[model samples]
Target: MQLLIMRHGEAGWHSLDQERMLTETGRHQVAECAAQIAASPWRPVQIWSSPYIRARQTAAIVSEILNCPVEEKIFITPEDDPGLCLDALLENQHSPLMLVSHMPLVGSLATLLVDGHRRGIPFMTAQAVVLDMPVVGPGCADLKTQFLP
Candidate 1:
């Protein structure tokens, strides 16, 4: 399976954590990233995003561009465990999936998939990483590419 892990775009700070919305720049950033993805060989069958407002907004843009369905998943929230996220992926039968979530979770998920550890790679806002996995397990995936907007 191929996984596209993305950090939500830059969000405004005035709202409650879960309610924070994306800034104008954030929308542009995600749109640019989505455009690049649409031009690539990879095509997402489904997109799962954190329930947070920012993440939902980011997913909306991606779904619009890719013409893929988006589902809000509780397991992809900022504070959720990376292992649980992996388990969720394992439960899904779909391939070429996209996950739009937050920092720490996104980075941690990548580390857990590639290095078998929780130590996370740094992710800038609106950054994305692609992983090629034979199965959903620790250290089973290889980093394919990274997209920054």
Candidate 2:
């Protein structure tokens, strides 16, 4: 299976973190990154995202470009466990799936899938990494490529 993990674009600070929206620059950055994905051979069959506003916005952009539906997953919240997210992925039947989420979660998920640990790979805003996973387990995937805007 191919998994595409993306970090949401830059967002302005808000008292309620979950309600924060992406900035104008963030939209542009996400659009540019989405264009890159549109040009690639990998097109996600399904898209999943955290229910947070910014993450949903990012997933919206990707969904529009990729012409795929987006599902808001409660388990992919910023503070949620990466293991739960992994298990969620394993439960899904979609191939070439895309997940739009927040910082530490995106990084932690990548690390857990690639390194067999939760050390995490740092992710920039609006950046995405593609992983080729033979099986949905730790250290069973390879980093295929990355997209940055």
lDDT of 1 by residue, 1-149 (tens): 99999999999999899999999999999998988888887778899999999999999999999999999999889879998988888898877999999988998999999999999999988888889999889999999998889
Model 2 TM: 0.98
lDDT of 2 at 59: 94
Global CA lDDT computed for model 1: 0.92
What TM-score, computed on C-alpha atoms, does each candidate reach?
0.98, 0.98
lDDT of 2 by residue, 51-146 (tens): 999999999998998899999999998888999999988898998999999978999999999999998889999999999999999888899999
**Model 1 error, position 46 (Å):** 0.4
Off by over 4 Å in 1: none
- Superposing all C-alpha atoms, what RMSD in Å does each candidate have to the true structure? 0.7, 0.7
